[model samples]
Target: MLTSKQKKYLKSEAHSLKPIFQIGKDGVSHKQAMTILDALEKKELIKVKLLDTCPLTVQQAALEISMQTKAEVVHIIGHTIILYKESEKEIYKLP
Candidate 1:
């Protein structure tokens, strides 16, 4: 879980990032999860978009993806969701 301050910080940091991943009608797959994991390692924070064709809502997709990848859901606005995780390499931090 993230504190209010942390969430606020992450939200601001993610504002400039474009959605790097998307969840469509097929939902999340194992391969996609692995891909996201790799991205997370390098980026630490990212934005994901859930298309209308997706069976789940933005919030649901955000939470599910966060759970699968061990990241945190910073926010879900419209069809966009922001995610954050601290890099083990310490190359990036979630603020």
Candidate 2:
């Protein structure tokens, strides 16, 4: 689990990032999970948007994706969720 300070820092960092993935009517899929995993590996932090057509709520989609990709849910605002994972070679150190 992330500390409150870490989450706060991540929230600020994510503010400038564009959503890298969108969950639509089909909800989360294996392909999406793979993409998220890859993005997390490369970037360490990512944002995902839950579209209006998505069957799950922002929280649900975030939880499911977090579980699949083994990433932490840093924040969720409106329809967007921020996720963070430490890359083996290029980990992001939280303040």
Candidate 3:
């Protein structure tokens, strides 16, 4: 779990980041989840975009990604969602 302060800091860090993944009409898929897991492994913190066409809520998407990757939802603003999982190569500490 992330502390409020940590989450706040992560939100700020994520502000300028562009979404690396896009959730389109097809929505989240098992294959996408696998790809996202790979990305999460490579980048401890990253952003994802949820398209308006998707029926699922951003929260739902975030929940699905977190549950799938065993990561944390750092923040969700507008159509972008931030996710974090400590890098296995090194302990990527949160602020």
Per-prediction TM-score: 0.89, 0.94, 0.89
RMSD for all candidates, in order, please.
1.5, 1.0, 1.5
Candidate 3, superposed: residue stretches over 4 Å from native: none
Consecutive 10-residue window with the lowest summed lDDT within model 1? 86-95
Clashing residue pair totals per candidate (backbone < 3 A): 0, 0, 0
lDDT for residue 22 in candidate 3, whole number 0-100? 96
| Candidate 3 structure quality by residue, lDDT tens digits, 1-95 | 99998888777777777789999898889899889989888877889999999888999999998998888999888888899887777435666
**TM-score-sorted candidate list, best first:** 2, 3, 1
Q: Which regions of candidate 1 deviate over 4 angstroms? A: 91-95
The per-model lDDT (C-alpha) reads 0.84, 0.92, 0.86
Q: Which lDDT tens digits does candidate 2 get at residues 1-95?
A: 89999999989989999998989999999898999999999999999988999999888899899999999999989999999998887666777
Decoy 1 TM-score against native? 0.89
With candidate 3 superimposed using the best TM-score fit, by how many Å does residue 28's alpha carbon deviate from the native?
0.8
Highest lDDT against the true fold, candidate: 2
Our model 2 lands, by Cα RMSD against the true structure, at: 1.0
